[model samples]
Target: MRYIASQIGRSIRIVALSLPLADARDVSQWLGCNANASFNFHPSVRPLPLSLHIQGFNISHAASRFAAMTKPIYNAVVRHAGSKPCAVFVPSRRWARLLAADLLALAAAQKRPGRFLHARPDLVQPFLKRLSDKVRNYVIPAQNRVPSY
Candidate 1:
């Protein structure tokens, strides 16, 4: 969308909205916006205040870094998501599976074993059975467990 907008002639005025970016001035220049028209606001300047948490680990290994983050991720979700749906984004499918298993284990250890599982497995079982063996092996056992939430 930005590429297409950038290609538009300057005769047609272009108005764009985006998250606060480090290179916003360059982006404005690329879009043919003059200094007076281009507005670059700090990330903290927002109508609705947003909270962002960034955590870094000193671990050099990729696998070790990911493993170290599992507990922190689980803690953040439990702290912030209070009865609301939450989503966790990971770097790869393998990491996603590993994190999901780790999160489940963490929840279990906290005495909330089914915290992340679906409340109604009967409704989800048919779809689960339809999945291929590779996916089923990773998902079935987790789905079979009762969901307390």
Candidate 2:
């Protein structure tokens, strides 16, 4: 598209959307965009805006780091998401399950045990029953508070 736009000379206007990159100016130059025509907004600049919070844990052990982050993650979700839908990404399925369990425990402690869970146990019970024994052992107790995927 850049080549085509460049070949078209000044007759056509070229517009591009991209992730913020260090070489944005070079890219704009390659695309034949003048300084006035080129725009490189920061990654945090979004149409709807975004709230970001970053915390670093100095814990050296992976398990300790993960355990330490669970409470903060739960607090962030409660503060930012409120009743809105939110998603949390983890490096692995193991961490995902562990974080989920920890988050549930946190909610339970606050007397909002089912705050982040789906209310449809009828739909979830059969699915839970089909899980492997190892999974069932961890999931059964929280069946009523199963996180909604």
Candidate 3:
């Protein structure tokens, strides 16, 4: 995490969303807070708390074709990761539907044996009731809010 001075007299915690692999040193030197933050550039170790977010997919429904297109991406991701892997993000109801559809497509594309891993959320209950059971279980629950008068 990085910190920056705030106009409201609070320190803001910052984390870079992503940076090019080539500019790693410059980003750390400039954004890192400690004097010896330079040592973070060492090549031998993996970094902690990395996050990846893919956005802008319609969340209400997942179609068969879209699911087919995404199967390769998911397969590639799985092949690159370590064993005992877990996914942290939640997809909207639409995404869940899409993912389910995608998985079906994946199953169709390949004629051999397969294993499925579903996404899971840390939170158990959600405020919204209209979402599907799969989505509700897999996503961070929304907070119930009273409308202002």
Best by lDDT: 2
Residue 16 in candidate 1, Cα distance off native in Å: 14
Worst 10 residues of 1 by lDDT: 131-140
Model 2 is weakest, by summed lDDT over 10 consecutive residues, at: 136-145
Q: Is candidate 1 or candidate 3 better by lDDT?
A: 1
Please report the candidate that would top TM-score against the real structure. Answer: 1
lDDT by residue (1-149, candidate 3, tens digit) is 23335446665554554422445667666664455544343333445444353434454454544555475555654565434443523347666566654544454456311234233322222343665554433333233222223
Task: Go through the candidates in order and give each one's C-alpha lDDT.
Answer: 0.70, 0.71, 0.45
Cα lDDT for residue 144, candidate 1: 73
Global lDDT for candidate 1?
A: 0.70
TM-score, per-candidate, Cα-based: 0.53, 0.52, 0.31
lDDT of 2 by residue, 98-139 (tens): 787778677767877667755455565668656555554444
Question: How big is the RMSD of model 3?
Answer: 11.4
Model 1 clash number: 0
- Candidate 2 has an lDDT of 0.71
What does each candidate score in C-alpha RMSD? 6.9, 8.6, 11.4
For residue 83, give model 2's deviation from the true position in Å: 1.9
Roughly what TM-score does model 2 have, to 2 decimal places?
0.52
